[model samples]
Target chain A: MVKLTADNIEMRFGERLLYRFQHLSLAQNQTIHLQGDNGSGKTTLMKMFAGLIAPSSGEINIQGADSLPWWRRNPLLGKAVYLHQHPYLFEGSVAANLSYVHSLCEGDKATIMARTEQAAKLAQLDHLMQQNAANLSGGERQRLAIARAWIMQPKLLMLDEPTSNMDKLSQELVLTLIKDLQKQGTGMLISSHQACVLTQLCNQMWKIEQQGLTSTQHTPTMAKYSNTGQSQEFSYVTAS
Target chain B: MNDGWLALIQQALSLLFSLDPEVWSIVSVSFSVSFAALAITLIPSLILGFILAFGRFPGRWLVTNLIQTLQSIPTVVIGLLVYLMLTRMGPLGDLKWLFTQKGMILGQMLICAPVLVAMSQAAFTSVDRRAWETSRTLGASWARAVWTVCRELKVPLLMAIVAAFSRILTEVGCSMMVGGNIADVTRNIPTAIALETSKGDFAQAIALGLVLLILSLVLNFTLGTLRGKAEPRSH
Candidate 1:
């Protein structure tokens, strides 16, 4: 199973320390909900795990990654797919964006193409295949970004505020995609300030508060509320 | 006077259309030299620009400022420096490139590289950081990620190239100083125009002038169309 482990990681910006944690590990079949206040460096932490940025003072090791060439320094990159809160869509059609990761995928051409078509359909973007990704609305852009990641079928995925700009219908669509990924045993680290439909899927919770990180095994009560159609109240209690 | 002007214009057009050997040779020499300079300088200058924009290292600020200063230095000054280097007593004198097209190309490369580097650096600096992050997170290699970013800023990078080409093509100072305006050898459009106009031979000068003007119009209009089509990206 693919796994990421960080030890004695301390993040700081110039002179101001953001947060410090002693030990953390994310592995396959683990679904984590990251919680923090605004400006708590949730995004920065996720980016660090994705190899987009270096930690101020720590080493992060990746297990079960392919042996990279000597010139390729960080193995964490491409091992974990990180989705930004406001996803960036390339200057091309929706179809182009969906197929961009095809070359990076390990499958054969036909399999990759089939996965691309499936992602487009699952994201409900098949109708807009020829449309320019730049012209897509915020919700549509998020969907397209997730769909692009879905085509990769990554071992680990980090979603930073995945449903922030999404509506109810769009959220449902994304939820279904994430559920499918979970069923396929993809590890996920999803960051959200408050509990939402997506967070309910998490079996563990990580909260960053007052320059410290704490982890706990979380049994989501919202699933029952969701079933009983009282999720609005559950969301309010968890948010506070 | 109007009749004289009309006759000169007619003669210029005729020389161009008929492809008079002398006029065409000058045009050919100018293009060949300038194109050589641009080709030799393009990739290295762009790589330097990208490093300046993204890499953090000691002396980066000093290098950036030096390049900005180089962009503003007069082309004639650059020509003088190149001339000294290629002179008989200078360090590079053994190669004996002075008064030749090689000398002209060397002079023009010095004039062209700064503009390309500075402009491309600006273009790369203005690129969205998310572009790089997204590409890397999507499993693109570092080289591929950089290529993707460059593709996104293709219009601006192209503008830099066009600007550098125009500068080198139209520069008479470097060509005249280093090349000594040798006929059919180092005499480019600008240098030829200067020599012909000095001798009151207006027809050939006007013909070469017309070529430069047409080239300028074509390059600018093409860049304008590209700029117009590149919609402003939103976050």
Candidate 2:
């Protein structure tokens, strides 16, 4: 099923055309890799898709309800989550951040706590759950971001450069987590410069060139890692 | 100069610690009237401040400019306006609010509201837009996003409150004009100081001035502490 669609979207800043798309659709359980240079509107497009901002001219329909408020429209179909290039953590502990999303979920307190615990375990942050999120290292914050969204079980997850400035270990954990999310039939739209890490997981690749989205292709084999249950080490050299 | 100043300070302290009835009554009236005004003005000013900080609408710039202008207007001007509106021949004359504590409260609220709005708007606007966006994208409603912003910027918001309170509490012009400086009715600290000075009661005037000075010092101390503790971007 086509879970989301954007028809003839246009983004303009004053007289300059930033980018435009004729038609775009994300089916259930699909993963689309977005490749673009810095300041190429990749984040802008993601924000529009998430209904955080409105395009200059376009219709974004989610599960046939086009006119519902962005926040309200998500629940009508399923949740849509957008992750910032650098995710923001509330001023509190990791558990507090997780509990924020948990409270937003439709569940009682006990269920919320249980899901929060499960997510912390999945993100390998259980031990640090009581620690302040701001005090966490960069890789830990990235993992926390994934964990924060994971507990919500969004139908469509839009991640903007989730693994840009990380060591190999953090990259593998994020990729592994992305793969896990894919297995659960979540539609993922990811924008990243590290195409080597995403090639194996993304079935379709789209690139922004000359103010338009053009489909591209890449082939890279996945470097398997040992099943040590922690951040797996990888020996793959990422392309410049 | 040294002896005269020291003597005045000594006299002021003696009067203050002695809990002089007339002086204490004046202080009590000042606090009650200004606190009532502060409480009434806080909610609406905060709401307006948040709106001004985040809202995009027609004439938004104009409204902000108007609030900024009001923030700097002399307190005596505000007093005159309130006096006109509350006089027997004025539009609000039926309420007979002039020369009453309630009348004084109305005038102080007018004085404080604009200060609160202007300062708090700046406080809220200083916050990163990303915080609000993240909260909303994560499923918070508009009001909830604002509440989150308030939580994130608690230090600045409290500073705005304390600043507004200080502005209204020490202002003499508005209380004097609207309260008529009536003894045991609406006579407050500032007005009492003015009367005592006019009557050549320098000791009493110095005592009241000392109290106002102490209050200012205490408020500023709190502001300094809050600045040390404030981590507006901690989120």
Best by lDDT: 1
RMSD of every candidate to native, in Å, equals 2.4, 4.6
lDDT by residue for model 2 (B1-235), tens: 6888788778888889999888888999999998999999998998999889888999999999999999999999999999999999999999999999999999999999998999889988998887787787777777777888888787778878888888888888999999999998999988998899899887888998888888888877877886775433432
What lDDT tens digits, residue by residue, belong to model 1 across residues A12-103?
99999999999999998999989999999999999999999999999899998889998788899899899999998888789988888989
Q: Model 2, residue B115: what's the lDDT?
A: 89
Model 1 stretches astray by more than 4 angstroms: A224-240
Candidate 2 residue pairs in backbone clash: none
lDDT of each: 0.91, 0.81
Score residue A42 of candidate 1 by CA lDDT: 97
Best by DockQ: 1
What lDDT does model 1 reach? Answer: 0.91
What is the Cα-based TM-score of model 2? 0.86
